[model samples]
Target: MNYLCEMSEDKSANEVRKIIHVDMDAFYASVEQMDNPDLIGKPIAVGGSKLRGVVAAASYEARKFGVKSAMPSSMAARLCPELIFVRPRFDRYQEISHQIRAIFYEYTDLVEPLSLDEAFLDVTTNKKGIQSATLLAKEIRERIYQEVGLRASAGISINKFTAKVASDVNKPNGQLTVIPEEVETFLEKLPIDRFFGIGKVTATKMKELGVRTGKDLKQKSIDFLNQHFGKQGLHFYNIVRGIQYSKVKPNRIRKSFAVEHTYFSEIYSKRKILENLEQIALDLERRMKKKSVSGKCVSIKIKYADFTQQTRAKTVLEYMSTKEEFFPLIELLVEHLEINKPVRLLGISFSKLNTEETELDQDKQLTLQF
Candidate 1:
């Protein structure tokens, strides 16, 4: 079919789509709980307990006491004096993540992973030929529990945003489906804060402007919103009208591979900066190989102590995958830049991607885990 005809067919298909958003319940903390029965039903957090450290994940029990992920551990401690803290086991989590991803692939290839814990799946045309999305969601959740021993919440809707929001409506081992006919009503009653992409600051600003709910937001003129919130204003306008058109990208194609590190203290020594750059190059090399991608363009980003940032780039003669080929260009780029102030951050990225997927054995994939 021609591209335009295909798009017209896609639009019609979308009207009856079966998009499912699946989110693992308290993934990190739940993994910790499942491995240790003694930790079940107890207030536990997975992350460092040091004053400067942040909570990586909080169990449902800890959440009752106002402890949440990314909150300072000290604050979490104050919230629940008897809170038990466990260090994050990222390798274990990643392994479980891959296992869960395997289950997703059994259902549909149109899976877009939002994180290690959540994903969006377009199952309109699924392998199982299941007609009802609600039934498919139930089966998926059941399989996850039986196979992975983890509870997953699911949401089914005609589009991604609605499906994502509905997933949270009934969380921690629950599911909800919003049918095509109810899309407008569902969004209208939803609080502005509950809409994806509208953060605390924006929510507060919206409240002050009488944009308290999707219904309120829908009443505002696009030009007025555009004048106030720039391009995002138009986005808000469209989504409130149930007009989100983003697709589920399964391959998870990456445009660039990069690694960055921020130093607590600024460094003026050229030797220290170069050392950091070299390390970053190695890290980027590992990331690229993991994703099975390389690029012809290379770039380096430098942030000064004053928070000023600059990026320098070069289109190399060939696609480069190893750090050895890119290190010399990185050095040259750093040398060419004006460095009157100490450096606070350094980063390296490779763009203009080569799309060929790298075939790796199971052992190689395991070794490539970050």
Candidate 2:
């Protein structure tokens, strides 16, 4: 009787705020379904209005046929002949994103949005005082579906990295949580490729050094890992230990937001290169609009067919968010670029975001405290 009473008392006294990450699966396609009932049963792909356009999202039905985002629309069609490609409606997407953000704010202002479809919320001392994070994730997912006609995946863990990874374990309305005791063991046996922060380039490098699994990575000395891969090696070390302290940055500053694309065949002509940059500038404009900021610095990235890369940046006289002004910055970037080498990829980024206050530099750089 004494032990039971103590347990009950502790449960009431020990109130810890829980952080939860919620990610919508195929968010754009889901929104399309919500708008059009006929599209619900069909395989949908969002984006691809032009011949040069790419797929921004693919529904689960189309995913079975290997369709994916960032893939060329032509290639996606080749892969899934039945795929229905639609032009992106940014207004609709933004409206839905706002609705989701509003829901998160209703719970806690501790919400840190990673993207339109993904966010982390800290509800440690919330009004609801919910105990189970898993149940909370379920309720949030249900609310999203019922109110917005969308599906979302959720991950609940002690920190952001683990929660983000756990959210992907099950997709398309899935929710998973990392119980405290199981975290370490679960990370140890995980494949290096699946480990957070290990991108394709790093994975290839790790394989060359015989580090295929998380267990394999666990064997390496910090000195050895750092000597080879720089600070990223330190990241590998922490994740293996199942100790990531990275906080959900309340509002990550829009510093140098850009998109790049690699061509199957490199282009040699200057006019063609300028045309491609124009397209990238348009995408940059869209992203800047979404982030709600104008940037004073515009930079361009160029990669050669030989894998050699170069970047040029210029601090403009003033902030600009529209494509009209942003393109001139690209023109300035092209002025300094070398045309001798064929262009494999082209990218554009804008930095020095303008908001009510310029304090974003420090907050945006909030170290992933692992």
Candidate 3:
């Protein structure tokens, strides 16, 4: 059923932001095949041979067999008996990512990387003096193929979120453009699950709320959404109406260090929830140590059996880099939550970050003063 609504007064149809999203097609697997011709046309998964390891990337051939990234190696092997597992070469991926970024810089310096495989570029004004963002997308994709020896897909839209969603419309090296006037029509027919910020859990919740399409989502009152979903509710209210104002934030700072655990079975016990939270906190601590950074805010995310999720966060007086500093705060956050329903997921993230300070040598401070 199509959910229908009149255009909200908050939305505008002006095509102000010319955004392009470029996504490399099956990047890691494709790179492996490129370097080793024998692997071409074969079903391969890149991650590792370890049975417990997860698939980091799957070739198109592997994907056809229901193999996918994050699938355990053992399960992938079961699904595709001939699936070849290759260790991830992150160094190589980084090198290739640099090459792609160089190509982007040649066109526009407004590139914002989503990952090694995908990025958003605002080419409303470009270095090449090109007027059509659509044409520039085509050129960038061609350059990636010719110079980087990889196929890339492009999506051109009025904004970043729509551009990101459009890029997935025709995958494995294709382009789609959503023009200024077509934004509403484009979003109206799109599935709720395909909306940029909505995850699987959120999509399921939306489906339960009779919000199956962007049109359906638009029908809900902003107050009703905010009452149920908090700040994200307002975000959904805006996006469905094509009201996103998020710019392509270049050099976006890392806001949080997080880790989560999805339980195989629903967890009902508060003690078990705390245990899981502790492990996640320890993992986050390790990650922060490795990065040599810390933050003042600690947040706990909980997803219930019904797939409804909530997060509670607090900013403390001092930088928190270890479990000892975060666990108590997490405990306080959890105390306020209603965990009557079985918990499906638990996570901890540290935000409002700061780099740990090292005392400067007195002589260095004096030299700087001089």
TM-score of each: 0.78, 0.77, 0.71
lDDT string, candidate 2, 120-155, tens digits = 987665556677778877888898888877889998
Alpha-carbon runs more than 4 Å astray in model 1 = 1-14, 259-280, 296-320, 326-349, 356-370
Per-residue lDDT tens digits for candidate 1, residues 1-370, read: 2222222323654356779999999999999999999999999988757443467799999999999986767789999998999988878999999999999999899999988999999999999999899999999999999999999999999888899989999988999999888988999999999998899999999999999999999999877887889878777877777676678889766677788776545678767888999998998999888877799889999877555789999997789989888899998888887777878679999888775334235447879895
lDDT of each structure?
0.85, 0.77, 0.85
TM-score of 3: 0.71
Tell me the tens digit of each residue's lDDT in model 3 across 37-155: 99999999997454545677999999999999867677899999999988778789999999999999999888899989999999999999999999999999999999989999988
Counting clashing residue pairs in each candidate, in order, gives 0, 4, 0
- Model 3 has a clash total of 0
Q: Each prediction's Cα RMSD? A: 7.6, 7.9, 8.7
Clashing pairs in 2: 17-124, 245-369, 245-370, 246-369
